[model samples]
Target: MQTKMGLKKNEIDELIDKAWKGNLERNNVIALYNVNPIILFQLADSMRKKVVGDYVTYVINRNINFTDICIDDCAFCSFRYNEGYILSIEEILAKADEAVERGATEVCIQGGLLEGMGLEDYKLIVTSIKDRFPSLHIHAFSPMEVYHAARTSEMDFRDVLKELKKAGLGSMPGTAAEILVDSVRSKICPHKISSDKWEEIIKEAHRYGIPTTSTIMYGHIESIEDRIDHILRIKRIQKETGGFTEFVLLPFMSKNNALGRIADKRSGIDDMKMHAISRVLLYNVINNIQASWVKLGLDMAQLSLLFGVNDLGGTLMEEKISKSSGSEVGEYLSPEDMEKLILKAGRIPRRRDTLYFMV
Candidate 1:
């Protein structure tokens, strides 16, 4: 029987072998559309094992979106609030104290780009957190947020990042990057910063010795070619800067969002395929691939271990963004719970920090 994409049996084997041996060429990966789904999955699983091995890492971190009020209003988001729900700096600090009480070593403090707030507001928040909890790593803000801050404050991007670093900002979370192609960005998030701007902010952060993770939110209006290009773009940047610690694959959540209204629905299988394919394609630049349990349900996230994901992502003590978007997964996980989940998946779980240091 002919496969859905008209893939031959032997060609699938050749691609699988190339990926498994870590010698798959970029052109061959782009030719993946002609391969059988089962063969592709098998190849991805093999490559995952060869590269990442059996240990799965989970970080004890808390995600606190200081305010949900956003200006961009991207179609695929559910976390942004209008204005009334914006949390005060004191309220945000209270949440940080709670996170520290719960054994969080890192706090991912981010928010929508408030219209009038300057860079000093961000610096004050970071300074307060640093002054209170000297040990907590403040993995705050994305390039999108940074760009917005720079635009609002009339300051250079590098200087903005440097100030944040001085205020004890630990790292940058590679969010807000839906797809690195302007074509995709134009359709989904036209009001958001351009792809080049996002890249510039991240590259500038790296220049100031701040490490950042890279993410891709796929399975929406983007084509398969665009997805490949996104990965390639990140790989090129990693080669140039060497600042990316891991690559996270975030499947586009489409429940109450506008994109869901216009496009057909996506499934867990699609998410798994992206995770697996990421591992197969980005062999040179990244060593760790994370499965977002908050986006993909826990079961599929657990199953993703076989598909080239080495990290279970963060045990986010409080996650409002994805959950607000119709994600039914729990908001947080204890280190004990992470261990149980990893053991159930037949792998040993190790606790890690933002730097992937075993804790």
Candidate 2:
């Protein structure tokens, strides 16, 4: 078979086999640009099967946006605001209770950086959550939040992380990372922490035995090379600390935001192709790549399964950040719906925890 781009089926298969064997070179992966979508998907699917098998992992988690108040008014964000009422400790605990009652194993608690909030406030929140739901995995905070806490508390980043961990923080959610290139970040999120700072924080987290997921937000004012650089940086870190659990690819949803006003366009097939390439390139540090159903919708997310994504993200109980960004996709998902989506894509689905363990 010859693809639309004239890439032979056997050649794609050979490349996939080499990638699985860890023998594919960077030049070989770059050569895949000549391959068409159909063959590209084929190679991605074959590689997924060879390494991770047919088990597509989904987690039972809920995103609790503790507050929308943010100091960093990123151009691409619809949730950040300098003025907004922050969630009280009682309200946060209420949300945590709701998540537990709804059968969620993980509670991803995050919020914008409030200028006056100290490390004591974060400790109070985490301690209260663990005091109530001791079993619930607390995958809270991003590097940006940590950076903020470090600054507010007038302590080093490591000290803040250590205190938070003692207060029962489990993992980092990997959101502050929009893209690791400072050039793109300077253009889009100048107020946010720099890329090097984010890397240092994540590495420090790993050093302290805290595992975290890595993420990329693409499709707005970033070059393909920037995307590649983002993945490569994560790959290098994972190589050093072996701390990343998985990689999530978030497409830029250009609507109801500043970037959207500049150019209201979402990522297309090319975006999905880059996701596939990430799975192929980060072969050593990353074993599982997740497709965000909330952003891509069910159809495109299922298509991403063929493009080297082995995970369908989570059965998010409440996802306000992405929805607030103008994603029309539903915030809640049932276990049955998750299995059905994976099966429809001709793969097996397994529920997992933050650690990617089959639950």
Candidate 3:
């Protein structure tokens, strides 16, 4: 029962037992931060196997960031442009067409919030895509976008979500939820939605039967306790609404943004630990944990799979947000490349749509 890091058999067994039975206490989860990584990784991988078996999944998707103009000044954002340009409806459709030609099943569309942008415009984007690609899963917009649309149109939030759904928005992206702690958000993204507001929007989306992904941005201006609090909030919502399809762990990329001025570099071990701990913490409540290859390189992403990650995210034909934030890895990753990386990690590779159904 001894691991490579020489941790005790009984201790590892106890933690794993707690995790499997979903009885891991907050104090014990915090204690895992000090556990030997060899033990931590083995236990996490064991839990992953129990729930998802050895099949590692990914999506052949495209990210079409229609614009870079945002009004809010988030400290960690480097993608916002003062002279933001919104793509024409024709231009947006062209990108979707290209994605379909590349064998994509989903197109993830998000952008900076533009002033005077109409709610009708958001609906138009969804309708245009669906009209052309009836079967394509349109995972468009974040909670912030929904909030913005509601404010601009002077309509109720749930009403706005319903209109977008009627216009053909298959799902929503759970961005703008940097951390579910308001104190931390004040320092990172003060102008963005509060934690309670975010939870409200997500729950509303769930009530409308619009499934969305859940996310957390870490490694910048947040404590270990803040991370735990964030996940607990997401877990509570999932227990109630069952709206989240997967949990995505995004490490803060602080190189060219305002937060980078004081942000410290995160070690690879820290990145791996977050993925492993997320799976251990959110075991039964949320099953899928994604390691973002756009942020973590292929090597670290592969290591994450052994630690507790089951999804490698999407085969994004083009990505700009991470690159704008100074991500050195290029944006485009082909399907062959994605499968190769997953195979090297010693797991079965499968392609999934936005809803986690095999495609």
Candidate 4:
């Protein structure tokens, strides 16, 4: 059993066994990526079987980006606008109603950090939506958004999270975490929250019992080592808090953005490789490794299942962020479409809510 990369079966098994027990070192984990991609995929798929089985899950969710007006300039973003419309509380609720009409069980809302947006505004968004649809899970705000709210409102980070939880924030979206290395952060999103600060906010959310979805934006300016470093850090936090519900791998969408000038576009193989390697490295610590269909396109997303991915993210009624970055993969996927994609991959498609419970 030799692979194209000249690796042997026993060697592959040795690495896979170490990963299964969570004993693989950083170098050991990095070594997995150097093997023939087919071998890498097989071992990761095997690990995925032991960890999460063959059931593929997706959420019935909608994205409500209330505003595109952002203050900080991230080099890789095309979604921000110098002048953009901020959805009023009524407008935001109306969108949620539309999502409900479309059979969405959850609404994922995150927008640019608008000027004068305080913790109250964040709370109001959650409360207003909750008031209207008490059962709909409001997965709103990233760690940076929460940090911004705390600063604007002049409150402590933990205190802000508590207030938002009380106001009906069901969970947080782990965006704004482009790459958790400060050096990379300085180059891509220098004005954004530091990697350490993002970790702190996520830990605090876990401390307050608010579960969050974790994410990583790769293939832009970071090295392979940087990617492993970011995953290890997330693994450590999950070890401490046990709060992350899932880990989403976002390949940097590099068209029509400032960073596109210098950033290299990731190949489909690289996209699948990232998902596969992440599954092996994080193993049992983060069981749900999701493929971003919007970023990877439906075809590649389906192939990702065999590459150690188990979740298909959400059928966002409308997704603007990726489209803004010149992603022509479109913004919406119907439940039927999602089910078909999952089934075609020879896996069971289960509709999950915000917290991943089967709906």
Candidate 5:
């Protein structure tokens, strides 16, 4: 078979092999962007099979935005509200209780950096939930949040992560990483930490024995080179600490936000190409590539499975950020429904915890 980029089947297979060997070149990966879509998908799908076979994994989890009040005004945010409501300890516990009731093994907790919120506030939430439900995995906090809390409390990042870990923080979420390039950060989130700072925090968390899921929010004011640079940085970190559990792709949900005024919603073709490219690029480095069902919508998310996605992300029972940004796909999907989507895609659905362990 020949692709539009004038690549043959054997050449595509060699690309897949190169990815598996874990020494992929930048120019080769750049060339993949122009290849025929089907050929690109084939290359990614082959890599996916080598990594995790035919089983598609999903975690039964819930997103608990403890607060939406943030000080930083990100261009891509519609979820930030200066006067947003903050969930009290009892209220947060109730959400955790509800998540456990619905068979959730993990509760993804992340919120805005309220001015007064510090290490104590973070530790309180984690400890409260862990005290109530010893088994629930508290996949909480982001790099920026941690950075803010450390600064607010005048504590070291290590101390903050240590306290959270003692309070039962299962893992950190690699968010607030719009793009790892400094120029993009200056435009999209000027107040946010620099790319070097983000990497420093991520590496610190890794040194503290915490694993995190990596992410990329593409399709807005970023070139293809920017996207590749972001993934390569993640690969370099993985090569160092092996702390990333999975890499997730979040196509920019361009609606009801400042970013939307400048950038339109990404095309379906862009979604396929980005996810497939992520798979092939991070093949041996990050074993799992997750597609965000909330951002991609259920239909495109399933189609991503063929484009080299091995994980369907999580069944987030409650989500605010994406929806506030104009996602009308609703907040929740049941475990049964999650399986049905994977099964219809001709892949086995397995329940997983935040750590990607079969639940």
Candidate 6:
């Protein structure tokens, strides 16, 4: 009756039931991995059905990396250069205009931390974009970028977020949150904000009514326990602030990056496990689990539906960060193509805005 890991089968059954109810302990959470893969996936699919039914969602958005010039040298970066390029206001707005022309509902903006790009510079981008296209939702900036700008402007993080929100910032992108474990972050991105600092800034944004998505970058030096810790932290934040819109599982794309040279490579099963376990652990706390199609590749992303993924992220009319890390899936996926992938997976495709509302 005992499995190889020494837990009885009945114990795993109870664990699965507890996971369904969002009550699994830390040890039990790890034990779920040793449970039959089919059973684990089934549990996730069942959870997805109860939470979101058979509908799969995707945002028709674009990624605008306004600058590639960064100061911090993260070991996992393949996108930064000393003084690469910084788009002017006219150039940024022009990209927005092109995005609008191509039927994008939102524009996701993020880039490196330049020396003098302070709060005023950040606000200028938001305000000008809003002024030009009054209807476009601007999902921009990471917590680290906020911290950097705050330091540069000699302003508090809350004050920076308040200014950006006032300037039409729709939401914040939860990047720069690689593993959220201080140990892992120390190795991958030593100069980035600490995990506790990241939490403080995120909670501040949520308290101020600025919603943000949560993310984790795995498949590198981080252990499965590290990922669970990251997930629990997200769940705790949602419990306290009710701010996270969705939880995104971003696998580490290990190519053309320094971290890749020494990081562990994940198998196909690992990708599915990350999605399935995230769904089981998150349960009702964070209902939407997104699988990044660009990083997972189209086929793997589509396969994730059975593993409890309900969102395929965005069309990403243009994506550079992942591309720089050696993603060869190209930069775009049309709305029609998005729907086809969802339909092929036997789920209904629902077009969504940045905030997950039907468009």
Candidate with best TM-score? 6
Clashes of each: 0, 0, 0, 0, 0, 0
Point out the worst 10-residue segment of candidate 5 by lDDT.
Answer: 15-24
Per-residue CA lDDT of model 2 for 54-98, tens digit only, reads: 888999888888888876778988887623768888998898898
lDDT of 6 by residue, 170-227 (tens): 9999888889999999999999999999999999999999999999999999988999
| Candidate 2 structure lDDT | 0.84
Off by over 4 Å in 3: 1-13
lDDT of 1: 0.84
Of candidates 5 and 2, the better by TM-score: 5
Off by over 4 Å in 4: 1-10
Alpha-carbon RMSD of each model: 1.9, 2.4, 2.2, 1.5, 1.8, 1.1
The weakest ten consecutive residues by lDDT in model 1 span: 31-40
lDDT of 3 by residue, 180-283 (tens): 99999999899999999999999999999999999999998888888988988888899999999999999889877999888778899989889999998889
CA lDDT of each prediction against the hidden true structure: 0.84, 0.84, 0.90, 0.90, 0.89, 0.92
TM-score of each: 0.94, 0.93, 0.96, 0.97, 0.96, 0.98
**Alpha carbon lDDT at 35, candidate 4:** 81
Candidate 5 C-alpha lDDT tens digits along 45-71: 988998899999999999999999988
What is the C-alpha local distance difference test score of candidate 4? 0.90
lDDT (0-100) at residue 28 of candidate 2? Answer: 66
Compute the lDDT of residue 136 as modeled in candidate 5.
91
Better of 2 and 6 by TM-score: 6
lDDT of candidate 6? 0.92
- On the 0 to 100 scale, the lDDT of residue 17 in model 1 is 73
In candidate 2, which residue pairs clash? none
Model 2: ten consecutive residues of lowest lDDT: 25-34
Model 4 weakest lDDT span, ten residues long: 1-10
